[model samples]
Target: MTGIDETFAGRKGQASATPGAANVPPAATGARPSETRGVHPDAVAAIMAATHGDPFAVLGPHEVGPGVWEVRAVLPEAKSATLLTGGKRIPFERRHPEGFFVARVETQGRPLYELAVEDWDGSERTRHDPYGFGPSLEQHDIDALREVGSNVTYRILGAQAKAVDGIQGFRFAVWAPNARRVSVVGDFNAWDGRRHPMRLWQNGGVWELFIPGLKAGAHYKFELRGPDGSLLPLKADPVAFAAQKPPETASVLQGTSTPAWHDEKWMATRGEKDPRHVPISIYEVHLGSWARVAEEGNRYLTYKELADRLIPYVKEMGFTHIEMLPITEFPFDGSWGYQPVSLFAPTSRFGTPDDFAAFVDAAHEAGIGIMLDWVPGHFPLDAHGLGQFDGTHLYEHADPRQGFHQDWGTYIYNFGRTEVSTFLAANARFWLEHYHLDGLRVDAVASMLYLDYSRRQGEWIPNRYGGNENLDAIEFLRKTNEATYTHAPGTLTVAEESTSWPGVSHPTYTGGLGFGFKWNMGWMHDTLNFVSKETIHRRYHHHDLTFGLLYAFSENFVLPLSHDEVVHGKGSLLGKMPGDRWQKFANLRAYFGFMWGHPGKKLLFMGGEFGQEKEWNHNQSLDWHLLDDAHHRGVKDLVRDLNHLYLNVPALHARDTEAAGFQWLVADDQDNSVIAWARKGREAGEVAVVVSNFTPVVREGYRIGVPEAGFYREAINSDAERYGGSNVGNMGGVRAEAVPSHGQSHSITLTIPPLATTIFVRED
Candidate 1:
């Protein structure tokens, strides 16, 4: 056996002269030439300072001579260390006082050994050496990472649990090209940076390490030194699958276990249908405040609880889909998930990742589609987030004009960068694929399309073509849409873009940003303004209701009375009506009838359906108790009936995006405050006629044109007494006469209810 006495013979005199050797006590015996010749003292100094860029070269087993091999380790907590190989124990020499040990052995090939360590408190443990393994990533991973739209960042980075050569552990990796050094620090290593300095792949600027014996649920963070050799704040993993509940910012190790999906039937047929031609009535919800268990300290419901309570309620309300507010992990509750930190993690505020998956499964099983409000536009500048990641503006632009959002006080993603754009595009695909989500409503897309968005003249930078459009962001969006549709066939992407940039919902091959649908902000603004006016003065603003039809088919649109419209002193939808309590409810019911009759898909914020009296407060539950009121319950029933009608009637939804589906029958009746139109289905002679009276006066003998001479049955009347309105109607049916009116060969005369919208379907 070659003991420490023979290995340290020549190193005694030389230790006093080496750079960091004075701090290391001399070994017991003189060192042999084979044991001490290969290792350098300067490398030891760098390792002792925890600033080594290439720890793999100096710390792992290295061949010293023809048959001799030397091994080195930096075990900070160990009082003594030994290398166990080939059924023999070789004790290591104490090269430094900071627990740096070295051992030389005679091995035929490379050495495979386990470390036996004794701590200062007299406790002993046996563990696999972290440096014993080779690199966990390959050249293909680096090549894929640098390619535009490759979307391999998540698979390559973050703490991934796996087995390396029959030993179970985690392989931690991060992208920090500008970092001089990066270390994986966690509770396993006593939060010490010196314990696990990672090996950098220079080609991709990724640092990786295989830490044997780490289990799932272990908290970890990347400790990085900037290019200038300055230590940066420990940053949470950008691609973390799960993170610690906020106020504490470490990333948790989530194993490679996927939830067993039971949504195959939903997934199999979703891609076969076209979203534009289907009846889509969305109930927008902020899960945190949707409902709280007041008895349980008013806490937010878990994902499982929401699956049980929320899904049944939505199904009962007759909504086809539920579009949730952002549920990605975010730091500030007030941001309502707009400013996300971990793009891949479902917010821990609800439950684990698997629990969230179960909620989606429940939604699918109930025949309800689920969509997430995805926010990739901007991220908050929290210290532990992606801001200033890697000690530089690696994920964001260095220039404030291109990087900072003045209105939101957040950091805009550097979409121009290949890695950053790929990161975002992959995240978009991740949610759709991993969670089996039906759709993603991309938030704040207008902020991403234009460089000068909400900025003063000199506060923004122009594109390469000297235009205000953000070219890089535009390309990123197009590629992301392409990837999402290609990978997750049934899923769709909707843009909450408030701009008139043409063909936002068009295919990318036609020089348009490819989104499945675009939110019609103009229609929302115009129609809401028209309904909020007093009954007598509504005639002056009559065009507000009619003007939207001029460009209704410009893009596939979603007529949204979203959360944005009900918050920030904007008041509830009920509060926006200018009238007494009874009139307010009447006007809101009429507006809902009109909206359901209009030429687009639908989305209504949660409280708007029940006419919540107060404005939305993100801190508390929605005024669910308001349903106790007769008028509020009536409004809720109206919404449920409207949804059912929209779903069952082909004429109302079959050709929503086509101009041939709608025709104006009495559009220019501003003097009487009345408007009328007809909706057609794909098949011939299938039609539904809708008329609205803005004034509070019942108009008898209201004549409207029809396509064919038949009996038209009153399908829905907003002024029915059951809906809290004066009982006024055409006695259930109106027969068309052979008289020409408004260019149609047939006409029908009926009583138009006061402050109501009445819908008629051809019965014969």
Candidate 2:
């Protein structure tokens, strides 16, 4: 059986599983094996000197002579020590009294053993020796990690439960190449760094140590002595898989277990379909503030509770997916999870990584996808985080101009560094591979794409080519995207990009950034601005509603009324409308009608559907009670119908990103404050007509062109009484005549409501 070596590399003295040689070293001369104090002075002195750098070199076992062995231990907590295993209790010889024990015994081969100790407090305990095992990871794995560019760091680094020479221990590894000494410190070693110094991975910059007695759920942190041997702050593990809930700030050692996945069927079929042509309506949420247990101090719901409650609500609301705000482990709740300290650990606020996995599985089973808001562009400058790690700028650029994000008071990653790039790439893989998330909505992508983004001219540095682009960040994004898609084929990446930068959702092979979708921030800005104005002054801004069509097909897009719009003192979507209460609800209903009919996939932040009045507060639960009011319930009902309609009607979603699927019927109706368009599916006779009237005056017999001569049903009307409107619309349907109007051969005349939008689909 494999355990402590019982001997250290067969040093010339004695080999022992039993303590005390017949003769001991002389104390006056401090000789190897002369009769004096019953223990060798060299071994005793080495034990007293804790900074030997290699505990395995002198403290464990040694073969001093033929068929003879020596064993030693430096147990600072012990008052007495004994070698106990295989039914033999060999008492140790106490040499020099500072808890140094040495013994000698004759043995033919190495033996499995344990250390028994009596503490100064009169308590006794036994543990497997941590110093006797072989390397926890294979040499090949270490070599892969040293390459730095290879995407296998997650497999080697961090706290891994591994078996070395058949002995189980928690093998800890971290990247701190500039440190002179790195040690593992925890309650096991009385939080003393010198008690268990780690072995360096020789020029690779990684330090590792296997403490056999350690196991999952142990709290630990790394202590590193800087290059010049100056003391820096103790830092949490960058590759830690779980961390103590914040305000605690220590990484918890965890054992990796494969989650029981029920998403196999979802995975097998997602690759065959193109998301651009599918119905995608995402409901963005902040898990902490989404809901709470009011009866229990209004605390956040656990992942299990969210899985049970949130999943069914979204599915019933007809949403295809739920896009969460950043769930990565961040220190500050005020930052809304944007300032992450641990990329690998899921924020322990909700639950363990396993709980998050169950949540994803629940979503998949409910036929809804999950998208995480992944923040890789920058990190918080918390002391125990990646900032000044290893007493150097290991993960970020050394220069403030290049690395600091002035807007966020955070540090930008050094994407040009190999280890940094690999760490990010592997992290993305971990989420997809382990958690089974359907996609990532990459945050702050605009900042990553340009060097001058949000920076004054003097505050930014140009690339090597003397341009404004951030080439290193661009390369890093491409690597991460390629690796994520390669390793998890069905998964996707979306960019929250607000720039004219070209080819964002295009394939990387064609020199594009390789994203599946880009948020339509321009659409959101112009449309919201238009609807926020009074109807009397809205005619001049009619172009705002029609202008987005100019670039609607520019890239695969998701028109987002996201959290960014409602946070940071910006009023709620409902509060942004400038009118009386009735008019306010009408304006919101009409705009949502326009949005659903617009040519892009939909993404609405939490509280938008039910007309949340106050701005979103990250610390507070959503005003779900607002649904009790008719106006709020009306908006909610309208949104629910809009979602169901968008999914059922092929014409609305099948051509959301293609130019051929959309055509204008009344582009020059600004004088009447009206606009109409036809959305077409690939099949003949599949068409949807969208008309919006921005004026407060009802229009009777409003003639709009149709693609074919047939009966048209009012698919949806924001003015319907069920949706809190004035109840004005064509009874059930209208007929198309052959008279030419607005360039189409067929025309339809109908009573259109004031300040509302209506959709009509062909019935025959």
Candidate 3:
């Protein structure tokens, strides 16, 4: 006789010889085995067709029972197995409710393959086939699908339209084929997404539970285990209506039936101002660092406290807008909100969802527009959410080419899927619709639109001719832009794309990416380099500063000194200057004036307004004490003044919308500097002359053209002592004398100060 293992393992111990056979009679043998018996050969053929024979080869048709059979296979070799199976394999591609079957096969403790069983009727393939955010499956892959287990389960119930009182309850269901029992435990049940032990319904295939008290704002997740007490993947519920943070378990949220809103009057009363005319003088602030707990006090700032303390200051400074960094729920404490796990849930770390809504409402009431920094390119690999969700393919794809992002060490969403697109689209709408935000500034767009982005040669695939354009991603972006604009006509959407993609800011109907504006990264880079250099050196680099104009028309732009440039290894803008404190102030002042004068909207980080001396650190508060320094205080005043002018000047506000608003009066890169023009509201002969002498020495007799023969007055000067300037040349009353032009127009003669930008207005 064979060894015990050998005797029972081959073909379900079919005896390899019928017991009666030679031992008794042909009558004892079952009627000729049914042709429909054992594994269906067509099913095996389908598996071969899908994977191209990548994982395993079918070995048998041996019958083990009346309806069951033992099918064997030569598993795909171990190293090659990972490519087809392992953690990255297609999951839930095949699942059924009749028999509740999912099959996954393993070799030597490592998943070598999987196969799913189909039902007698055709309902199995039609109903359980994976799509969108659901998992993918392979043939004969039951055991493996049973291995990873379920992250969340939901039941759909049709409630009679009349049954809804003040609160409505939902029927919840979970599918855990491997679990012996399950429970709903969450905040409603006091930290139990797995309590009120769901009743095992309909042949024990599904565990179902219902809570009469569930409603929006409730947080939750589920806990499940096997008969022998082995724990399965107890993950955060995927469809959780809402969620909270650490030390507290997630609860099932009841979606809001009626969101409290008082903004209809506000929306109706506001006029339809052109977005280009909207004066976007953004003040960027980090909520955590803007204020903090004293060593002797609490460690957090309530949303209300921040609104009372900060909103008034911003409104008083004349800022038209406020842009906040990411507020998504994240696990890491010190990050700049780059790491995000939950797509639908807000960070419980800040304040409750209602509190966040109130903060935005308060800002709107104060007439300050709000822009949120949205990070959708990638997500943190936190196990509690997104990662390995629902036993497979939740937020990512099975193939690394479609799944992993090399640069961020995070999972990129499979934008190609309908459910994934819906998830993100809903998220965008959630903020705009539910929270009443004015706009969104999408973060890290470069990563989202490129396939080869941050990948090594062997790691990524290119088009047939070897190019980097991610066609699917591009299509997805096109759809996203169209849907967003269609949903909210007036809300702004800005892309932080660093690459040279064309038409990023154009309208979608025009075959463009359809963002309302792009960050103007090229301008930011060139301007920073030019201003930080010595004025003399700037003369040689003047062309670099103006190079941005070639592509400036591709989209609207915003010149931003955002958190990315200041917080990382890159030094603070103030620290980059090669001069003393006074010279440093001069450089910064000139830069700000130049930035303001440029044909784009403006943004300054919180501390930059008051001249923060230290680099940004998320763990510590902004250097608030630095405001005491005279130089620092001067910069603050300058920013406020700039804001005042930005709001009041037609020349500035008008620039926001029309290309004709800005005109260059000079382009002399040889002289190390140049001058430009800005006009307002088609007013004839009404213009603003912006002149900068990047040279170290003052240019005494520099002459530029004017529209008319009137004298010009200095509207704002970077050399003013009150604004951290050296007070050089006292431009307070310097008038540019008008000289007759060779043509019908006229000209002006003025002394342009070194390291200063002067905005001249024609005296009426």
Candidate 4:
């Protein structure tokens, strides 16, 4: 379904108030009054119509004469209103029938007072005037927010519970530049837009109000009247730190919580270290489907519960990091947290924002880093969201071709606009600075890099130079990277770019996108295709095995076997093999062994380590019961060993992005479906030789050349019996002799396992 249709039932690209029209208060008496009085006619009209641009000008206390003050209050639900000072009561004149009441204080100005209002139904209540406070947005903040990107927009704009002048309440602010007026409406005022009209900063286009005595957890939305005086639907705050669960679109008032960050050591050293040459084995996970309580109606684990279970599980698996699919607040569970509605708020699916923060803390304490799959290319066009905000294409572009994403039915962010660009850049910094996430893996980067992505020739608009490159998005990405890397030192930004974009992982100052790493999509595609072919046919397609070496060092690449490979009808990684059960298990092990031994970091999606036979289903937990089988358990064990081996051995990880670190021993033994290579560290002796035989034929006395003459101990053999393999290969180790073979002077003549890959480390 289109995102527009998700919130609005009618009126495309226009704000019509039927569902929200009830929020607008009925008009008061139309008699024009003099402006000298505090309760001016314009203020009354605006309050009655709920379109008064600035309520603070007239509603709050104003010194009408020396030592005498005129106090005005608009309680639309009240029948009579009075001002309450300590031990004294001052009555208010009902100026308009729409609950516009006024009172004059003669003693030492307006004095601290509260409003006691009697409703038409004989209900009386007393509360402090919400409009009595002043606007908190300064001119400097507005200029900085509009000019250069600022990271504190969330702190300034959302519903925040704070003590204002010693009065406790929630402060609400939003940016609706073109709106005629805006108001803070919630259950506190019966969703009446006229009850608490906001103070509009004319130049900055920001509306704000502080309601005293209000607490957090109250649901609220900004009720904006369009520039044309047309009432718009109540919108959820874009910078909201918390939100009500989906299907109920309301931003929640958030309370302050001091983060108990115990990861100072992790943060201190993480920035100084270079990840390119280090072993980073990431386990990509979809939190909702990772596990569930089957007996509890398949409910998902809370953030704390996930910390209890997932933290130890990943640490035990020896993975360096856990990459979670976007946990940002999304309206639909099926979007997998991609089409986010609230970027600042962690999804309420698991728990509160603090709950997610706690989860990160727990992971860090366990020595595991966490990465988020951040989606910034586009957002859902839900009416309450940024789409057509203030009855215009404020957040997105005006034209459909430029503004819309056809494939996803979402709204593309107009990165060229300064406010929009700054808002997004700030969001990128929010997660890293607030929740202490280690890195971001930007999703759908190809779509952002190109104008014609997933579109026909006429459906897309080219750049000023008539090129397909999206210059604005490119600039925005650079800005985001600069902000993230600068603000959150030691954090990483990875790109899931599918195209052959140049210098994607290079430094921004050196003319690049500035991501720390890029996903090796070509390697994933080619290798998965090669492994899917029958053993006899694999000989003809040997280039797939050797092709990745051609550009392995092009960027700091991460060899990903991710969720995209196992979802839909693609089947599991184990299920993708073209072999019987035993052969399938062997092929998977061999493929993983090759992957771990390759010249790059590694990523394995959830359940792929255990040889999950079925395709990934986001609605349910993975087939964990399969672990009871020896083959499944064997696959898990192999992954664990691969991670440990990769971390401990410098040859496997160090200099992974340097061409000098790799040397091919045999690249043209395709007839036997065999390929061998050596990985070297910065110096000699830090080397590992890998040999893979794709067929079920054990090649005995296979003379493989090595650089050094020493005892080559078998580090990992995919065909070992412990890994549920046939155990037909090297027993413990092989000794290399001074002989020339495959261009190397030292040669190791040994038994090669069938349909397996093996790693042999030369002893020191």
TM-score of each: 0.94, 0.92, 0.73, 0.93
lDDT tens digits, residues 1-764, model 3?
A: 21111112233212221121221122222332454333333333422222111111122223333433333332221111112344544333222111212233333421233333233342322111110000111112212212111111111211111112233354444434334445555555454322234433222234444444345555556665454444445556544444566435353364433345556655554336667776788888788787777783636577777778778889988887788887766667665677765544556666776767777778878888787888767776766666545445556766787688766678878776544554565566656655677788988888777777878777777755678777656666676666556665567888999998878888877877778888988888887887778766776787777787766655888888987778777777788665778778777877788787777788888888777777787777777787888888888888788788777777766665467776666765457475555455456656666777565567776667666656566777887788767565535434444564323256766677767777766666
Candidate ranking under lDDT, highest first, comes to 1, 4, 2, 3
Which regions of candidate 1 fall more than 4 Å away from where they truly are?
1-35
- Model 4: per-residue lDDT, tens digit, 243-328? 99878889888754557788888877778878887889999999999999999999999999999999999999999999999988
Stretch of 10 with least lDDT, candidate 3: 126-135
- Model 2, 1-764: lDDT tens digits are 01222334353321221122211122312333321223345535633543333345445655556656667777777889888745888888876666667766667765567889998888989877765554454545656653433557877899888776667778888888787667788867887775676766554567777788677888888887776667678889898888989778888887566788888898788777788778999999999999888889989999999999999999989999999998888889999989988888888999988888889999999999999999989999898899989888999999999889999999999988877888887888888877888899999999998999898879999999999999988888887888888877877799999999999988899999888889989999999999988888888898898899999998999999999999888989999998899999999999999999999999999999999999999888999998889999999999999999999998999989999999999988888889899999879998999998888889998888888888989999998999999999999889999989988999999898988999998878
Candidate with more favorable, higher lDDT: 1 or 4: 1
Give candidate 2 misplaced runs (Cα > 4 Å).
Answer: 1-52, 64-68, 85-87, 93-101, 109-111, 146-151
TM-score (C-alpha, index-matched) for candidate 3: 0.73
Best by lDDT: 1
What TM-score does candidate 1 get on C-alpha atoms?
A: 0.94
What are the lDDT figures for the candidates, one per model? 0.86, 0.82, 0.59, 0.84
**lDDT (Cα) of model 2:** 0.82
Candidate 1, pairs of clashing residues: 7-31, 8-30, 8-31, 9-30, 9-31, 10-31
Runs with alpha carbons beyond 4 Å of true place in candidate 3: 1-183, 187-210, 215-218, 223-232, 238-242, 246-254, 257-259, 269-271, 295-298, 463-467, 672-674, 709-711, 729-744
The TM-score that candidate 2 achieves is 0.92
